[model samples]
Target chain A: MTAVLALLEFAPGTGATTGFRLVDPAQPHLTVTDLAATRGDGIFETARVVDGRVQALEAHLERLAQSARMLELPAPTLPLWRDAINAVAVALAAAGVADGSIKFVLTRGIEGGQVPTGWVLGLPSPDFTRERAEGIRIVLLDRGYRHDVAHTSPWLLAGAKTLSYAVNRAVLREAARRGADDALFVSSDGYLLEGAVSSLLLRVGSRLVTPRVDIGILAGTTQADVFNWAELQGFTTGYELLTPGDLATADAAWLVSSVRHAAPVRAVDGVERPIDAELTARINAALDGRID
Target chain B: MTAVLALLEFAPGTGATTGFRLVDPAQPHLTVTDLAATRGDGIFETARVVDGRVQALEAHLERLAQSARMLELPAPTLPLWRDAINAVAVALAAAGVADGSIKFVLTRGIEGGQVPTGWVLGLPSPDFTRERAEGIRIVLLDRGYRHDVAHTSPWLLAGAKTLSYAVNRAVLREAARRGADDALFVSSDGYLLEGAVSSLLLRVGSRLVTPRVDIGILAGTTQADVFNWAELQGFTTGYELLTPGDLATADAAWLVSSVRHAAPVRAVDGVERPIDAELTARINAALDGRID
Candidate 1:
């Protein structure tokens, strides 16, 4: 709504990036302050930008508000943020890329403040190989973050993306250090949580399953949408607690997210497995055959 | 060490002020970043400055590193950070304010890069209260931070100053909301963790006791130094797990920190009690009879 462009390298009104920028509450200025860069007090979302529209925008917006609530933050004004994001997408669209991932990060702005004003919008850095569709190797690592109320306690921002993501970054780094493409976070109790940047979805005997939300797993928007679409696609879906063994025995595995969509999990701990063609077909159908 | 000066109207390193400047890290230039106006982070410490020296500076350094570690950060180089702190202290001393508190804040720097880097520093603003020793009315709050993991997770950088301190700020606000001066954090299981900014110490019988490190309690430098001093004063000191009941029924209770070396807890949760005499004697003797 403000109609100011803080970052370039993308068109506006269509999400082509997987990043976000914060708006100053009082001014049109954008600043990266101590609130998030240092403390990681924020939330983020990644949604698809298809034909200048943020796909599943409402779900992403709702997730943002829920995340804010987990952090005990006042729910951000969705309409205003939407306008800001839309403006950036439109700008990016005009520049070149029309359809891509939109990364939105919301951080607690400034020092000593509770409300988040620090936001960033940008395309995700081009890192993941498009070959991920075939499958990617993921290594499991211990995050040491317990699932108790302190860490797992529901906050307006708990499931919401907060900027205190150093642990997530560290987890990813550790995974890479172990020669894996991505990291699967395991709770202190040895339960596989989720990937650092994506949600884990496994297919077992025609059932699409992921870890339950109560298991301290983030309520992933992409995974949720996939689940919803799965129901419509005549596939039985369930949310249940999962262990590595359960994942290992799955007919097929995949990590779901906004950018990667339904990238298949080809190998676990170097164990190669056959891809589940039927499940992939349903997921691709759910994506409307767009990911390629 | 980059020498720096803060222009403030109130006591040198105490209360929050509207704005302050730091000697620019890139050059000798001075730039003002108003932390008070920002409220970006919470729970800062200003240690005792004695005769152009920061008392137990290494301990404070250790605490700062520990805090950073808890927040899962790349440890700020001790010598460089210490140099900056000492520079500010030297500037303050030149302005003739030594033998007071040396302020330290762990704040997120300016935001905006893929990883933002905008750290700032300043001396205390006005309104700093230096009371020799005052009985404090304390309240206990449920911070939801795991007292065990939050208290003693070895990896969490416990006892270190971190920037994800909104909870600490919230605890103080909760205390103020309840008409208390400060707040104490208890685990979900009811173990007294520590004060919002300081560590907890109590005397059970003739032994000075605090929670052990593994209880998720912060390893308090001030308390540690006091324990060492207690040995000199012929008092047996031990660090063990403490619960609220243990605190309430203790022979005496005191909050230990850099500024408030040992403030007797007179009334906890409106249950008034007498001050612990032996605790006071050891504290006073440790301070060489000069508390204020």
Candidate 2:
């Protein structure tokens, strides 16, 4: 089997979790009326799994709950999700898949239906060895929102990692059209934001910096783990409101995600930039080591 | 059956239409990895059907093609779509449904797979007598983008009717929380944008106006029909850059959509506003009259 699928059932009215059922990942599971399929009305979290353990498990669950709160979906049951996640990770490990990802999604359910649809799907992670080794070429695109949109307009659903990622996909395609590997979104008002599917991390000498979490971006779980690991390695870490100038001046930069770990940004908008190859390899080693 | 579903199959490489298969709408037809469900990476067009004819069908198809161009999806074979759409509309009409909607969707297929996924679904329209006659209360929400985003950053997918509607759903929830029926969005730069799922039409005395299509809003098919019909009735029509202050001063206003037609705005942010009951009824009657 290439993937494992678990579906969650919710109790009526109280938003309490009833139970979960593991289903065939190959077969059809979602109806057309599912809000996730129709309106992109859902929240999701992807956690990397290694050696039968889900890395950054708590952080992923916490972020999922935070996203659920933002989208006003039923709050996810943490223990239930953690157990289901572990079950999927265990399945992957049993299949001899050393590295994979478990993506858990909680949608507002069928249109007008009372029950919400929740699922955890585990799939072997594709090899990102090249991206992690040689690094990635990136371009900065406008995110079409101000940096403070999360606070100024909560209804915009900024900072909430919802499934409405069409713009995110568009940016990646745009980057490809521009002959780049990935795209880092810059706010419309000239502040550095995050990547389409990852968080922007910068290294200046021994100090590591990432955009402030309060900005309109996801609080990246993997980035958080990298920061923790870097701190233990005698490096300082911080959250700051960064700009393109800061990124250009940094000693090294990366677009970090759970499955991909740390991918150094080797170029910006076709212009070659310095990459910390040794540090990137170390970060990936630490991520694969399952420090949690 | 409550709904009709037609799944479209495309020829390899050329994006030519091979055929369409009518399927069970109740069954799961899409994979878990379809880009539409995963990333909201799709475009859709919903047209109202009356007496076996889809209103503004050509306009909807053109807009769908336009959206496909913007999103870089396979250009929908227009005639195939027309036939499929008509077939679904005919199915609805044969089922004794006089009033209904045909929503056609074209998605980028399963992740990384070639050939797109296309579907046409026809469902009975909900009763909107209260919203049309009694009118709806509305609140203005910030859309989190400047009015010029479509031109400045086309990758934001602003003008395209993409499946990424989480924010659209969020704004409505916010409106309901504020004791309103609908939400109209304003650009972050203080210019008027469109509504969450409808187009805003205003009447400044003898003039009918809507926000310019170039200002990152959909070129509303229903509003276009309304304008053409109003011109026949000797009302001058135009597109202009507008603001909340302009909305405040308009003699009458409406939130018009494919399914609901023209719904007058009776209140704004809990404050009662003037609604042209006579004009609203006439407009709705004209719409139902199948002016096309």
TM-score of chain B of each: 0.74, 0.98
lDDT of 2 at A209: 98
Model 1 vs truth, CA RMSD:
8.4
Give the B-chain TM-score of model 2: 0.98
Cα lDDT tens digits, model 1, A1-292, are 1222332122233223323443332342322233443344556676766545666777788887777666655556666667667766665565565555565555555454433443435342343445354677787765554554445333312344654454454455555666667777666665667887789998877688888777666787788888888877677888886788888888888888776677787777777777775576667557644431
TM, every model: 0.73, 0.98
Per-residue lDDT for B80-198 in model 2, tens only?
Answer: 99999999988889989989999899888877678788889999999999999999999999998899899999999999999899999999999999999999999988988888889
Indicate the worst ten consecutive residues by lDDT in candidate 2 chain A.
Answer: A12-21
CAPRI-style class, candidate 1: incorrect
Query: Would you list the C-alpha lDDT of every candidate in the order shown?
Result: 0.59, 0.90
Q: Which ten residues in a row have the lowest lDDT in candidate 1 chain A?
A: A1-10
Instruction: Give the per-residue lDDT digits (tens) of candidate 1, residues B1-292.
Output: 3224332212222322223345333232111122211223222345665445566778777776666555444444556556656656666677566545565554332221112122234333332233224556788765444555643333333455555454555566567766777778776566788887778888776688887766665678778887887787677988776788888898778777776667788788988877865556567557533322
B175 Cα displacement, candidate 1 (Å)? 5.4
In the order shown, the candidates' DockQ scores are 0.14, 0.84
